[model samples]
Target: MTKILTTQNAQITTAAVEVKTLTISGKQVTLSVFRQLREEPLLTEDVTLNGVPWGYVNYHPDKCGNHRRHLHVVWQRGADLLRSTVYAPEVAKFQSVWAKLFIEAAIAEGLTKRSAESFGISKIQIWPHWATHPHLAEFSYGGVSFQAAIREDFADAYDNNYVSPYVKEKAVAITGPHGDAGSIAALKLPVAEYLAVWDALTALPHLFIAV
Candidate 1:
């Protein structure tokens, strides 16, 4: 037996892990904690404005064996990748404190521009947590319209027809903006599933609406 010397065998034991997203000017900054790792906890974060990458950080444990925790930085530096070494005995505690400081540093970098709404987002509507409703955001990409709305069914009395309740509670739908079925690629996905897709889309050069 080789004993399988790998960090993948570890597990995360945190009570709660929440994703914190910030909208500064028109840019979007996301802060997420991964306290579920078996060996150590880390913060995975990124920042984008106008569909452009301002900064990003990701933890790679397998490369350094949890001693010299490797934090990868994603930004234009003429190179594909670069890393910074973080040596902290108390890995979990260090990551929690580091996340806050990193956010401050990102704000000071002066990357946040105006609001995404102010730029060129007319069709999509973005609703934050503070708002009465919790619709994340909705917009069209390449003529494929997408919307994040409450996952409820129509009530009785709409032409005397009752719609069936959704099997999964919350979800989003992708369709054509104005009933163009020919070129429309309609899809409905749970909020959790769709949000991940939205996050990946933000990495593109002009896809992220910034709202």
Candidate 2:
């Protein structure tokens, strides 16, 4: 017998693995929940612009490196790509809710098949954690304290949208420390509550382009 777990916005079917179904914009979409960490995407769909193949939208969970255990989206077009974090890594459940919001954001940005290049909007800022991080100076580890100059440099790079020429090298310089401080946790919300927030965000006119 297949067991069903119901949430406020989705139904998850449990078996050897879990699969969730959700209703977004009156359409049913399915998402898979992995029993173990997998390198592959949980879901993927093609994105087109003006009837031309623009790229693919990939939904990844527990991805490696910076995206570890985070439910996120990767917008890919050959070598060029952009990534968006839909939900924080610490919120381990409600993968389907995050996926739904990702799709909805894509739709709101007019990245759908029928949309043209002129219809594509700038990237959405779903949450603060998606873009910002705590300053590095607050933590010290391995007897290595981040110097004031280093902290100022990092702040400058961050202020410049992380595009400083020495940003990568500066980041590498601080990689040895393992500190327990300066961690910020994302707010965990129930499926329905998160959806409501997402709805309000999508309603902003600047997030969409008129084609």
Candidate 3:
């Protein structure tokens, strides 16, 4: 549709209407290079576009200009427009202060659109996979860094049988700081899910039974 085009600095001086996204680099943080902040579990902070508190950014073609365009994504915060312009002299500097607009940046710059939704935002400079993930939420519960993983998580393993034998055995193994992983939650399960687990476990013996 017909949309107003703005400069990467948020200025309305641009005559072209194609969509483009501006990126800023934020503090360096740990994360998977292949995923966005909403798709990786290694980041921990909040970044916004203009003023919108967005989990990620996206790009689209502009309708006002023949070949001219601007970024189409919004800030993660609530506002639709930025109060001030964000200036980045060097691409690397911008890459260090704000999260990179993955697929959108390329599209804005006339690149590939194969990964528009896969772009990333920064939480401590790294990409994450979900909104309520470790970075967005407080990592420490009582007094832990939240990266704690241990080996005892394997004790409660089971066979789901919903898929192939190997696939059914797939499970979660979250653990604490040391190898002394906490025991399985002894608490009761919801009626339906509990029954489901029981049924799956029941089939285990027979499937594994000696012939």
Candidate 4:
């Protein structure tokens, strides 16, 4: 066999190996920091990193980190996420909205494709373990048309539906198949579409009526 090397092969391997850098930036800013409205909007995604549909939980212990707490979310890999309401300082709070924002932000940042869903496989997903410990949040779907069975059917009503099978350290994770190129694309999408997705995700909150 003749040994021939091409630069294109290396690029392909690099892209496949890296996938995309998901940087969930941890914020240490003082509460004095004025909450800034999103200067830039994001795109809502139907699936999470593990490819499962969005769902809600009530003050569940975060599976990503330890000795701490946070909301279970699938927001952009490296983006900073801030929400509307929170009570305690160390107690982190979030909802499925954060998950929607994460996907939208990825698209807005030019990290995802227009039809990224075409290439992505539906599977369960989880937030980072080291950074976010068990989280505490409440989720309710009343205004939005959500099928309650969706979450239960995903993992046969398993609680650890988002856990990764590769992660043996976490004893409570589900199984699923995935491609390296889930949504991140070699090409870019229009800004309008990006904003539209973000808007779409915001509508989710409306589905919840105050109890």
Assess each prediction's global lDDT (C-alpha) against the native.
0.29, 0.30, 0.22, 0.26
RMSD in Å for model 1: 21.0
Q: How many steric overlaps are in each model, in order?
A: 7, 0, 35, 19
Worst 10 residues of 4 by lDDT: 140-149
* Per-residue lDDT of model 2, residues 1-211, tens digit only: 7767567647678679433332235554334422121233322221111121212223444434654333333233454334343333223222332232222322222332333223232222221232234222211112111111123444444344443545444443333233111110012113334444334433322211111
Error at 72, model 1, angstroms: 9.0
Tens-digit lDDT string for candidate 4 (1-211): 8757887544443343422221223433232232231212122323213222122112222223343332222222244442322111122121333333223222222222233234231222323233343322121111111111112122221233232332322211221122122222222212233333334443332211111
TM-scores for all candidates?
0.18, 0.17, 0.13, 0.15
Best by lDDT: 2
What is candidate 3's TM-score against the reference?
Answer: 0.13
How many pairs of residues in model 1 come into backbone collision? 7
Ranking by TM-score: 1, 2, 4, 3
* Residue 27 error, candidate 4, Å: 36
**Residue pairs in steric clash, candidate 1?**
11-38, 12-36, 12-37, 25-114, 26-114, 26-115, 26-116
Off by over 4 Å in 1: 1-51, 59-147, 151-161, 164-183, 186-211
RMSD of each: 21.0, 21.0, 25.0, 20.9
Q: Give the C-alpha lDDT of model 1.
A: 0.29
